[model samples]
Target: MNRCYLTARGMTVGYDGVPLIRDIALEIERGEIVALIGPNGSGKSTILKSLARQLRLLGGQVFVDGEELQRLSGGNLARKMAVMLTDRTKPELMTCRDVAAVGRYPYTGRLGLLTDADEAKVDAALAAVQALELRDRDFNAISDGQRQRVLLARAICQEPEIIVLDEPTSYLDIRHKIQLLSILRDMARQGITVILSLHEIDLARKLADRIICVKGDTIARCGAPEEIFDEAAIRELYDLDEGAFDPMFGSVELPRPMGAPRTFVLSACGTGAPVYRALQRSGEPFAAGILYENDVDCRLARRLAAEVVTERPFMPVSDAAFERALALMRGCERIIDAGVEIGETNARMAELIELARQLPGYNTLLN
Candidate 1:
């Protein structure tokens, strides 16, 4: 049996006969959450719209569950797939429940009236998205976040085998974003294939099983999150000449402060992250060190700090690394001890602290 629930072959997509992206091919398995990520206007939405049959494909074809998407009847496709796009069309005098009930149209009788069972599913879907309280409220009167949840409820009530969403987290608060993504994760576990475009690379990294990077007229890269979220890959994918993307944290840092080191930061463990960011925000070129390559601090320092002296993880602070850090420290006007736990393995840290005290303008961050 074919495990791929959705397939796109030679898919060329665009607006008004002009191709924005060309020759796209994808095979998304059942229950996988695939996220499309790229720069704005990179055609992520265009690809999604074409797949959902909202836009006419300039070329190629889409298949859902072994049936060609274009060949499926409207009702047949509605039963198998649900799409939640960004365009919100308001209906007159319709309650949130009424909007969600529209999803039941495919399952309803010829008169298009929802049955009690359909209402129950609508209520359940609303409850799932924590929007049950808005069920009686006018859809047009709700906030964007609330409306997004309600629309998600509408899609959920459709009971699709696959769901396609475009930037679904727009206008949602951080909490709602988490809640919505959690709901999608839950849905995927139940064998619902989820395809969505997300501007939040961090959220995409966390939520997507596979990530498709849409760039410059084609699908540039498509693979597991681990393969797609590398520092170099993300930097190249987004054309990030400024700023740095940390794959480990799924975070982006502002460009490093220009010029020579002004402050020397001594830190270990994860303590240096905030200091690094603070220094970056202040546009202060800083040197940080005696950090292990695997240290969380080291990861960020490499991006924000003008100079970083790193040692291998689980190894004692080496003499060469200490010398390099000491050289950087001597050049800086101020030294900040961002705190470290003194242990037998890194006893050299104590020596560095003692040396820092001899230098002018040395301060400890910890109590």
Candidate 2:
């Protein structure tokens, strides 16, 4: 059974004694990665800062492993938790190695010098983040992405039970983002609980075991990724009246073309996704048809196309479905065959193709 590693009871957080968010409640299990996602200025950073003790709580309390957070000494808390905020460290004349070694401060002697074991831990942390090669370089001289990785290395070196990061992937490129997330996933498997704020909702869906949706002064909702990541929920969460979000792909599509469909596309399997996007980009209202309900193309077409004529899954195109598709095709200014294969179940598609060829405005991407 999983244990509650961190808990917030009626917690209120903000800055300067003003509550930005109030009556917040959370229970985070050990070894879980919980991501905070919300629109900008929704108090995600404030909540993280308060939990990590960087900002004082305006009301309520936080507990870690049954110990009240405020009662713990600074060093004791640091030993139990590690934090890497977005605030860039601008220490002059400090090497990357020197910055990473700061994680050992809570464990170091009065002189604050690193022992042999401490040095090894720092080296391992840098290597874990793929920054060992930059250890001797000047900290301020590296790029923002590199600095982010180094800071993560510092957090890893701390060896705390819980790690809190704010926008950890802000400065990372695609490759580095993957690398860093993979490292955090590995760390969590070894029983380190992870908490962080992410602007990338798609990434949050993929990575977090649980998600906390922060909005308008407090947590709007909190649940598993499956419960929180869906078309309606995500659309409402971000107030997306302009565009569409697809949970299957974790992608956002531009608002669908307006007015009536100007083009009719016949596609099946996975072929129509690109064509649908292309038509959307060209601002051409389009329709897709003769697709089974379960076809991958049907999924995207429903989002981008003005109309979609769909048949039942695993069933051949019925006369009713074919008539609807044909009606759409006849109304379109142009008919496009998007490389639908003539197969046992979908053989009626060939008839549609022949009719399209007879029509005046006919195009086939098969060639």
Candidate 3:
């Protein structure tokens, strides 16, 4: 069996002698990317700091490469693990290359001079993070996304066996977020252990080889993302309402159906799939109106043998189409709007909502 890179047994973490993470047990192996996630103030950061040896454990032990963490010297610990903390304060006038070079300090001589090999490693790290072009730019002058990439480069330059990042993507945009995580995934594949804290559960689910979900200062669930993302587990951990989390898409807030039905569903586009499926499962009768040929929901509606009033490709909503949709709604006990993207041109749908609101016995199920 491969030896674990980091191990914690019966661990309790806290600050100023007050325990926040209680009796936690976890093990990370080489080449694994572990995501630590939880609600705010749930001690995810505290647990990370404890693993990085920034905070003393209130109880239990943390082991790196089979040695107790507390027994390692500062330099020894530095060589074994590199930490990219959440609260990084950039110094004015410092170049990006200068900041990344600091990771070489642990291996440098007393004079703090970078040797030829050190420079090569720094350059390689910058290249790895796609920040080579920003190497000469001032750290404080760069965007948050660029600065985050530089920080990651600095951690890579440390050449440690393990890297711990606290909210590494917090400062990045969508593009940079994907870039940074892709780089981390590549690093993990190269046999380095990677662990990070994340607020974006979807990203965590996609990237993490293992997930450690903390809730109320304890381990709520810890396993593969597939195992942890079940409805019961997510609802319990996040205190979400029933039907709030969609297992297929990992969305927390499901669109609600507004007003009572009279005849059938007049929904088109992908936005209507969830509501259409729900209504079908509930055995409620619905019809489809003014469906576009390419809309997936229209196909589903057709499969369900729903009374469909369809239009030709790229055709305008004719008088016949409008009449058909209106006729369907007239028979519906209620009308439902399932996250249909409304625009100024879609004012008729808004009018439908108003009309439904004025009708007696109309109600919406707020999920």
Candidate 4:
């Protein structure tokens, strides 16, 4: 089993006399990518800063390698851990290589001269981030993504046991985001502890070995990504609106349709189904409308005994089919629009929504 590299025991962090993260208790082990996530102003960054010794702990303690963090000297701490903050400062007349070399300062003697070994490590770090070609370029002149990578290279050059980053992918495009995360994942595999705060929950879900969800100035949950990404856990942690818990996508948004109801459901492709399932389970009368055979929702409608209005294989909808569907919908006491997908062929669903919106008793059941 891997040992814990960092431990927070009853940690309280905040500004002045006010505490933002109270009684926070978490342990980070070696060879793990731990992602800190939550809503804005929920103290995710605050906790990270506090762990990095950038913020004074209001109460409790943080331990690095079984030693009290506050008791560790700056130089000693630098050897044990490195931090990459999101904000960048303009360092005068420094090339990217020069800045990354600064990470070796803790190990250098009074002269602060780089040994041959130090130079080689700096080169390796730059290459690790794919920034070697840009080593001669001015750090201040590079794009935000490049600058961020350079900063990460600096931390990697430190060869610290634990690395902490604050929103490392903040300014990166999708490709750079994936690249940066892949680098971190590789670092964790090499027995380095990697902790970072991120805003993108989906990316966190995909990349992190462990997840810590901060909310209301405290940790709402901490576990494997699979454990924390559940609908109830995420909905409560993020304070999502009702009907936002989506099991399939692990997001709090529109509900997806399971299918048409047994009585009858008049929904089309991409129409969400929680409402349909709810009505079906309640034994309400329902049927499904103008369905294409291959549509997922249509398949569900068929299973539920929803009088399906379907078309032949790969054929355009006929006028007779439209009339039959209209007649079936007319007999229902109420019509529901489940927010169907819109396309050239499916635009008729929007017309149906519009028509329902104008009806005397039509209602919408949004997921």
**Highest lDDT against the true fold, candidate:** 1
lDDT of 1 by residue, 76-185 (tens): 99999999998977899999999988988889999998878998999999999999999999999999889999999999999999999999999999998999999999
Quantify how close model 2 is to the true structure by its C-alpha RMSD in Å.
Answer: 1.5
Tens digit per residue, CA lDDT, model 4, 43-105: 888888989999899999999999999999999999989999866779999999999999998
Candidate 3 local distance difference test against the native? 0.80
Lowest-lDDT window of 10 residues in candidate 1? 241-250
- Tens digits of per-residue lDDT, candidate 3, 78-129, equal 9989999888776878999999999998999999999999999999999999
RMSD of each: 1.6, 1.5, 9.3, 9.4
Q: Compute the lDDT of residue 220 as modeled in candidate 3.
A: 85
Better of 2 and 4 by TM-score: 2
lDDT for each candidate structure: 0.91, 0.91, 0.80, 0.80
lDDT of model 3 at residue 274? 71
339: Cα error in model 1, Å: 2.0
Model 4 stretches with alpha carbons more than 4 Å out: 243-367
* Per-residue lDDT of model 2, residues 156-186, tens digit only: 8889999999999998898888898998899
Candidate 3 scores a C-alpha RMSD against the true structure in Å of: 9.3
Better of 1 and 4 by lDDT: 1
Regions of candidate 3 where Cα sits further than 4 Å from its true position: 254-264, 268-328, 331-367
TM-score of each: 0.95, 0.96, 0.76, 0.72
